[model samples]
Target: MDATELQAISDTLMRIVTPDMTPKQLIKAARKEHPNASKRDIARAAFFSIIANADQDHGKAKNLQAFAIAERTQNGAE
Candidate 1:
């Protein structure tokens, strides 16, 4: 995808994912628009978000990781 297409996909993802949404939720929502996007693609998108959040604020990565762990525990996710 081009830069414009990527930005549009990112924007669509952001709209679907909220603070309360889990990674699984975000991926599921992303799949609705990008059915052919691979698991690695979804992971890369999430990772980019993680990096961006980390860059915006120190310790954000750790916090997000911790949150992800807790979310996985709560959801019984592997």
Candidate 2:
């Protein structure tokens, strides 16, 4: 695959592994914690991380998304 395709795949995989972090939060946290790393690179890593932990159910993604949305709503109310 070309660099772009490979990067896209990498990003998706990372997200699958890190089911806890929303894509937006992952980008922000990665930038702050790894200042030298490109947001795109960090995102790709996170995606790969998720893929590594994936299962047939994808239950993790569903649960994480629900939790993230609820957290955002809770924080917004404060």
Clashes of each: 0, 14
Per-residue lDDT over 1-78 for candidate 1, one digit per residue giving the tens place of the 0 to 100 score: 555544455555545555666667766787899887654455545445455556654454444444445544655654
lDDT of each: 0.56, 0.49
Best by TM-score: 1
- What stretches of model 1 exceed 4 Å from their correct place? 1-5, 47-78
Instruction: Please provide TM-scores, in order, for all candidate models, with all chains considered together.
Output: 0.50, 0.37
For model 2, what is the error of residue 9's alpha carbon versus the real structure, in angstroms, after optimal superposition? 16
Which runs of model 2 end up more than 4 angstroms from their true locations?
1-22, 56-78
Report the C-alpha lDDT of model 2 over 6-58, residue by residue, as the tens digit: 45544444344355656566556545544556544544443443455446436
